[model samples]
Target: MSDKRQQLIETALELFYQEGVQSIGINEVLKVSGVAKKTLYHHFTSKEALVLATLETRNQRFSQWLTVQIAPAKNNQELVEHLFQSLKGWFEDRVEVLGEFRGCFFINTAAEFRDSESEISRYCRQHKSDIKQVIRQQMATYADQPDETLLERICLLKEGVITQAYVAQDMSGPEQAIELLKGR
Candidate 1:
């Protein structure tokens, strides 16, 4: 990626996370990204293209982070703890002495632009599906449990933890969720 295009993606992500995706316009991203209109257009044919790029960037970062987090775990139990600890770490990082922190950018964006048929929405849906698949794979490492039941339970718990931690401002919510999932 060109420096200009990379700047646009990074700046757009900051603005989108701080504000919102739909609320912020293409002109705003261009202005904030410090890229000329022609440069922006050269990289993205339209605002929807930029939006899809932004979502894909976020999805790539998330997948990379998750892969790193779960890489060291030996078993499903350790894997579950690693996942919860990662969420807790996010909470500790996101919440400083200041006010509340912004929640999951993807979840926020999905809510703001719910189920649209746009390319951005399609990328968002694919990212979510990938997330569920990751959980299913991890759950499979636990053996002895029915695959369907474990997949459903773990996916639900993961979603609940993500929402409760970010939206509900419960710092320990992810850890609590892990315990709940283990009990199940």
Candidate 2:
């Protein structure tokens, strides 16, 4: 992507995460991003299009970051541990890949777009499914393959972590998730 387009996405993502997508406007994004209206419209066509681009950009950044965080593992178990530890880091707002924690972007965005059939909500669901797929892939290795049920459990725990951490200001979700992993 061109620098202008990337700048717009980044600026929009930050604002959308800090505020709500419904609360932000195209002019605000352009102003914050320092990109002209013509440039933004030329690149995004519409505000919703820009929002989707930000979601995609966030997904790509998160997936790449998660991949790198789990790279030191020697086995699936260690991989899972690293995954939770990564979340721990994220919860503490220590991870640079994601800036300040403002809850799960997907969750926040989906809440803003309440209609599940809406394009934005659909994209959020797809991003979540993609995250679960990543976890499944991470836990699958030549020596041992985790069952689907276990994968689902872990995914649920991961969601729980994100939700509780954001909703209740609880930061123990990662530890709880790690404990769940230990029981398997």
Candidate 3:
């Protein structure tokens, strides 16, 4: 991506995370990014387009980070643990600084944009489905377990961890998820 485009996306994410999508305007992102309005519009036809791109950008960053975190794993089981280990670190960081952990970005965006066809909402759905697909693929490698069951359990655990981390400001929920996953 061009530096200007990336700057816009980064700026928008910061504003969206802080002031929320509904509150922040395109002008704010343009000003914070230090890019011209025409340039921003030239790159992203509309604010909605920019919103979708921002969501996809965040998803890509998270996926790439997760890939790096799991690179040392020797097998599927280790891979699963590595996944939770990352979440554990995330929660620890959140709790160490402040008790207010931002919940899942995709979930938050979906809630803000209830229309399924909205660019932000569509990107959120795609991002979430992509995450589940990764878990399903990893679970499928475990020949002994049913893929659907494992996916459902992992999804539940993920939601629980995020909820607990947001509300209780602790990593215990994700740690428990790792333990349960290990026993499977």
Tens digit of lDDT per residue, candidate 1, span 1-184?
Answer: 8999999988888788788888899888888877999998899888777777878887877776776776676566677788778767766775332113477777788778755885666777799888767656665565555366655666677777778877777777777777876734
Note the clash tally of each candidate: 0, 0, 0
Candidate 3 lDDT tens digits, 1-184: 8999889988888788666788899988977888999989888998888888878887977666665666665565676688787777766653322223476777777889868797677788888778777665654455455457656787788878887887677668867887788856
On lDDT, the leading prediction is 2
**TM-score for every candidate vs. truth?**
0.85, 0.93, 0.83
TM-score of 2: 0.93
For residues 59-173, write the lDDT of model 2, one tens digit per residue: 9988888877877766656766888889888988999879988889999999987688988899899998988777667666433765787778877888889889889999988
- How well does candidate 3 score on lDDT at residue 87? 77
- Candidate 3 wrong stretches, greater than 4 Å: 74-77, 94-101, 139-146
Which pairs of residues clash in candidate 2, taking residues 3 or more apart in a chain or in different chains?
none
TM-score for candidate 1: 0.85
Worst 10 residues of 3 by lDDT: 92-101
3 Cα displacement, candidate 2 (Å): 1.2
